[model samples]
Target: MKKLELTAQAEDLMKSHSLQGFPNEICGFFYGKTVEGVKHVTVIKPVVNAKEGDQRRRFAIDPLDYMKAEQFVIAEGLEFLGIYHTHPLHPAIPSEHDLKQALPSFSYIILSVQPEKVVDITSWTLNDDRAFEQEEIISNRNVNTSANKAS
Candidate 1:
């Protein structure tokens, strides 16, 4: 599995956003650069959970927001690394619905929000067999200083 390094600020933003949405699943996109097969998340952007049904159990980001995020990341010279969402009262693991819609090369970050608290955070990448495999997340908040300057 590839490693994911996230900035302290990015993680904090995720946690805070998840908490604010409390009991309901909130989602967003993470922007970053990937070097040597490792993804370094530098920024986290919170977006609306444009889901139709039960938000507490499921989350869906608006398509327009996705497009806007892509443009923003491109403008910032960062890659659209992946999306992050809170699993209210659930484990920080991808559910079946998540698996069904999972992107192969993109990262899926899940935050377990329990009782208005961010309990756990885990990153995942889909495998060849169509299953979610956990990706090791390293706290490298300071590593982005020079690592982000790339062609």
Candidate 2:
């Protein structure tokens, strides 16, 4: 299992978005640098959920958003680590929909939000067997300065 290093500021930003979008899933992108084999998520870039169905149980992001994130990260000298989304009433576990949509080399961070509060956060990565493997989340209070500086 790999480690998902989430900065304190990033955590707060995600939780806030989750709370604001209560009863519906909120999704976004994250960028960072890998240090010591850990996926350090630095910036939480919020974007509109472009799913075509009910958002309470489903969340989707457009491919263009990924390109934008990649470009921003490259311009800022960081890697496109992965993306994040909120599960309003579910655990911080990936669903079948998520597993099916997931790709390689990206960390998927899921936040469990109950009512208007964020209850938990977990990260996952697809393994060789195509199974979702839960990755340990490290709440990093002091990530690199670039993360702090990025909006």
Candidate 3:
């Protein structure tokens, strides 16, 4: 597993989506360079909420969305890093269900929009033990493109 790096715009997109999801989990795909020690997130594409639960904002990407994301990455010459989702009113960690579904190689970024007043974002790696271990996500504002990075 590796520590994921979010471009400023990517981070901003995640944060903004989290706010929109408010009481739910905002799910999406992250594309860029996937490697050990350093993972770069160049793009963020939001996915639809498909889970059965209504209380949680976390969304399970639609199958079409997954296919679209994969196609988009290839079209843009980018690598598929992994998926991101928000944990409303909870810690930026994966739940039991999340662990069961996640792959060890992908970077899972969880935004904890909890405590009501403040929102905190964090990243993690799902170890072989199926536990989510915290990882650091450094944001770089130097790169600019069509993606919105403003906070």
Model 3 stretches astray by more than 4 angstroms = 53-58, 115-118, 128-130, 145-151
- In angstroms, give how far residue 31 of model 2 lies from its true place: 0.5
Summed over model 3, clashes come to 4
Per-residue C-alpha lDDT of model 3 across residues 71-145, encoded as one tens digit per residue: 878898888888888888887767887887888778788888853432677777777887788777777888652
Candidate 2: tens digits of C-alpha lDDT, residues 1-151? 7998887888888888888888888888888789999887777788888889789988888889777888888798988888889989899989998998899888899999999689889999889888988999988887652333222
Better of 1 and 2 by TM-score: 2
Name the lDDT of candidate 1.
0.84
Each prediction's TM-score against the native?
A: 0.90, 0.91, 0.84
For candidate 1, the C-alpha RMSD (Å) to the true structure equals 4.5
lDDT tens digits by residue: candidate 1, 1-151: 6799987778878888889888899988888889999998877778888999889988887788888877887798989889899888889989889998898889999999888579899999988887888999988666443222110
Instruction: TM-score for candidate 3, please give it.
Output: 0.84
Extract clashing residue pairs from model 2: none
After superposition, the stretches of candidate 2 with alpha carbons farther than 4 Å from their true spots are: 144-151
Model 1 stretches astray by more than 4 angstroms = 143-151
